[model samples]
Target: MHRCLKIPEILLTIFQNFPSTTYFLEAKCLVSLACTCRDFHAPALDLLWYTLEDLVPLLRIMPDDLVRGKLDPSFWRQWSFSRPLVPSGFERFDYYAPRVKVLTRLSISIDSLTLQDLLQLSSLAKLTDLRMILPDDDMTLPDVQALDHDGVAVLPALLDLHVVSSKLANCTALIQCLHRCTLESINLTLQNPPSGRSLGELFMVLSQSACRASLQSLMISAHDELSHSDEDIVYSTVLAPLLLLRSLYIVVIDNSNWPGLDGKSLQQMVLAWPRLCYLHLYTFELGTTHHSLVTLEGLLPLAAHCPNLCTINLGLHASFKMTESLPGRGVINRNVKLLDFGHSTIDIDAVPHVAGFLSDVFPCANIISTWDEDEFEEDEEDEEIAMSTAWDEVISLHPVFVIARHQERFAY
Candidate 1:
């Protein structure tokens, strides 16, 4: 009977060792073991509660209605939605308040109602990190403003705040709210078109703020819709403010519409941003030689300014001529680490030119070439044998040279 008793203890030890196992597996095992006897029920319930406590907003939102429905009756009998669900009133808070300490990091992508619910449930005073994605609706501005007013004081421990969107009307107000809070780091993305004041207002806020000193990483993307005249205005406003930033990501869409910065403007922007480490560009409509080439030409001088830049992601309409003209010195000499060219045909003719360009501009960096497989097969191989076994061999034989350097790298 001593050997039989030891078997249960041995199994318990095995379960304890595998703490990193998936929540569903742990929950299922606990439920199964709990059904056997009263002694196993407590351990099983503790494991389930601990697993639920660690779940973030994203995990909570996962499509698990089917799994919840399928759980055995005994598992559902003791399960308490009141514990995990965001508490609202003081009565609900009293029941779940003790569990609020379990939440260390909170990330929410929802509207004001959900945000309010979260704040009401957990005391924001203890939160160390907060990442929120507001809905793409007009009503979000006021709600965000309200949240800033109410929660900013309580979130003294908040070290990081990340906000992503295409458009925001009261961005200046939002920045002001952030300034009130002692944030150590912030990541902001602008994807929506803004009217009235030009894009420069954002940079102006950053440059003028007390928070700028604390900021370690900055990403700015002008919406694709800004007019040529307005685009220049946006960049002009941002240049002076971004000088102190250590990390910067700037994306300009539709190169043809861009008035194309002159060499001096390029020099000023690059020289101003001395500490910049990473640069990314996504240019659309590259075939139009007059405008696209001029825009691309402006980028070469700017690329020379980033002394510490280690990674560059360039997504442009593929062209052998443009690739041949890309700047070579700074990226190659600085030992740039990563280069990504999105969905470009790498033919025998263009491949050599691209290789030469990479060797020149980003010589130390790995050149990652990516193209749609369907398009690659269609363009490079003959129609008759394109669907056959030989087509796979032919395609594999090509030296595509992706940054990751293998097919598995492309796997999501």
Candidate 2:
């Protein structure tokens, strides 16, 4: 009888030592073990709760009927799933209130009311990191604005906040909110056109904040409808205030209308960002006319200003004539360690010219090109396979760097 009891104990010990049992998997097994005997019940319950705390989304998505599931009644008895799990609203606070003390990082999809509830979750006062992803629609603006309003006063411990929205008005509000916090870094998507108030409001907020001095990184995207004049104003007002910015990424979405920046204005802005080290730019369908493609010419002068720039990414749409005028390899800074170029067609013959230009500009940097045939086939399978292969190849080749692609690359 004693040997029989020892056999079960040895089996349980072996299961606990299994290398493949991850935290989540182990927790599930513990639930089963707890149901078998009173001796395993208390310890298993403790392990289950500890593991579930690390997995917050499971709590958010746990179904109401989970309590009635066929698995085990005791497991459900200890677990709390009565509170609502919607991304926003009062129930979110009630559900998280007990567990917030242990949560150091949280990521959630944003809706209009979600931001409001997050603001009221005072338990998150100890949270060090928060990431909110907005839907790709009009709601993005209001959601971001709500966070912007409460972000300053509520999140004193927050070190990073990433907001993706589709309105310039929300971007303006986000900037204003950052002014109130001592944030170390931010990633934002500004997907709307530069309207009158949004543009001025963003600049006004940045100019007033000491947060600009503390910010180390920034990522911004603008709608293609913004005029060259508007872009110039943005660079001068909003970007100029970020005097201490180290890493920068600017993506200009290609609306049917091709928007290009003025060469002289770009030159001034590039020269002003002295602390900038990494720069990425994505431009789509800017016109073939003199006014449209002149922005590409500004690259030469822009490279000259950022002596410390170590990485550069450029995505553009251009005709052969515009490509020919592209300043050859010499304009690239020697300090640049990674160079990415996309959208320009490069045949075997043109590869050397492209490579030569890159070698001239950034001689010490590693050059990786995503060269594709000029003709694209309509086969969906081929496209899917090609994309999967391209992503895998890029990831394998460039581990620590990013590859920028034109907006058209995703358009069907």
Candidate 3:
């Protein structure tokens, strides 16, 4: 690199040209740039410290006494603090700590995180987004009580948190800590959730968060089905107060028992949370098989009111005969360009009508639904083709239906 290229602005522009996933070179390039000159130091350093994937960089800055654990200094990058160790120097958190404001993603085993480690992570002053993962061998139950101790609590300003394969007790502590932190989003994935009774208590804790009003996105998923007889708790009655919420995802992998909404209640949600831009609901139960649980009639309130809604994913009871339409509601959503029905099942009988209705509302949008080769019944395949033809026909000024070709990338 030339001296002129070391101008902070020029360097930033050049570095930013690399994709955000340019993780392969982000650390090396930014660190090298920071060492070049005093002028390039702050900008390059800012970029380098903006995301701390691990504690190795910080380990390099620590006083020798702090790391008395006979481990190699370089070994800290892959080290796990399983033993009861509290290095008393959080106040000594380095100069670059404040620059970390985005996803402070740390891949670690929950069992390996001692009180000291958890407290250390909580003390990331500027952390807004964080994701913690449990390694494959971490079968030990988590200690939730310690997570809630005043000695180690989350500070306000942290917004997004995601915990995968963690215990319900751990999740409870994290949610209860919301009162301390002004969090907006929470995502949890449990391979095995607790009993329905305990699960309800966990949800109640979240619904009653001190910062519930500030919450905007909440995603609770599980590999196993979470069946609740009291489905009302998962609906608008509990979440309606989050008027600022923009995205909501409730997915139960291959489980049909997840809670759902009817036309009236769904309408109420659309009215209550006008800011909702994304709403995804997944379940194995086929609404198309049973016509009453969910109906196309629900689309009335959505198309009429939700102007900011850009994406929707809900199972619908498709019918061959189109439902009655609103006579005078001319409202059209401009921002909603994607409609996903990944969890929705299309009725073989009503493919054309469903296509026509979807096209009528989102004329320029792309539609996504479940697509499987082996599971495709002959009747459904022909209907799907017919639906696509209907969609393409209405997309253009002319009646000619042209299929769009799309190439999807599978890997990062």
Candidate 4:
């Protein structure tokens, strides 16, 4: 054996250098290395169990005599155990749980797991990223008792939590799993707009979270459109708690009614999340009624508050709002690069006005319209094509105006 291979760091580097496109094939090699000798065992095992596709594989690691796996073909490849789970059965489970850093598609059957099962499974002290796609049926974590007397969380070191669910109850239950950890990011996709009560409970949990001050990114998107446009389901007061997350840099909320979010609310958002770099509030295909009360002028507050903001996407009514009347040639946020006006109304004649306004506010921004070539081929509405052309013209004229602004500055 080469002397260099004896160095732990060098060996780990060589092992990581292998192609990861096929993780199962890579795992085959790692299993071989684990069997080769003691030096390769620990590192190979660490890399092997670093990222898990689901908890099923980890549960399978336990002795077959202690826990047997049964596949139920009636439902979605659901796994069940032959015998009741006990604390003594988790010896091997505890061994490999700490090595896992990322866990995805983590769905536990209510019938398969009990309160005791969850307590034994919560030993993943080092888990940093967890993603769950929950079923609408009775999936929850309230039964799992809180941290022990010494004060430790279920996933104590969790940094990112991403969950996609059709029901809000599942999301509420999952949030209860978090105890004392300060999370960095959370992404949620709901198939339907949540009821007022469920939304309130969800926000209440987040507002009281230990990570409220530490959270950096938040995205809440709904897949289904509203049945009726009466009022905004997302009220200002319901979302007010998010303002407490002062360190937030990225916020994206899509396809949800925010009738209450007017120009005043927009200003409050800019002031609350001063470090915002990417802000996307889109309500495409929902019509102008769902658009925020903010006009094109509301963008100035973003320029004044979030100087480092790079990307901006909004559902504001775009028109001439006298943006040229700045104190000193307007506050230009040079960091902004992409400006997306998703299905907001803009007339062809107003292209130059919009372009000029953007050039002054976001001097380096490029206009982005969400429509694509495929939509055009599908014979989309004439209004969509007209708006797309208007945005394209804005894209062209923005850079010219930017150059003219620079020339004016040079002249001064």
| Candidate 3 per-residue lDDT over residues 126-160, each given as its tens digit | 66766666443434332555555555555445777
**All candidates in order of TM-score, best leading:** 4, 3, 2, 1
Instruction: Single out the weakest 10-residue window by summed lDDT for candidate 1.
Output: 71-80
Each candidate's lDDT (Cα)?
A: 0.46, 0.48, 0.55, 0.72
Residue ranges of candidate 3 with Cα displaced over 4 Å: 1-107, 112-122, 135-153, 166-170, 192-202, 221-255, 285-292, 320-331, 343-349, 371-373, 376-412
Question: 185-251 in candidate 2: lDDT tens per residue?
Answer: 6666555444433544654665566555566665555544454344433333443444333333332
Which residue ranges in model 2 land beyond 4 Å of their true spot? 1-100, 113-119, 135-152, 189-200, 221-238, 242-272, 290-308, 314-332, 337-358, 365-412
Best by lDDT: 4
| TM-scores for every candidate against the unseen true structure | 0.51, 0.52, 0.58, 0.70
RMSD in Å for all candidates: 11.6, 12.5, 10.9, 7.7
- Overlapping backbone residue pairs in candidate 3 total 0
Clashes of each: 6, 4, 0, 0
Residue 206, model 4: Cα distance from true site in angstroms: 0.4
lDDT of 4 at 82: 65
Candidate scoring better on TM-score of 2 and 3: 3
Model 1 per-residue lDDT at 360:
52
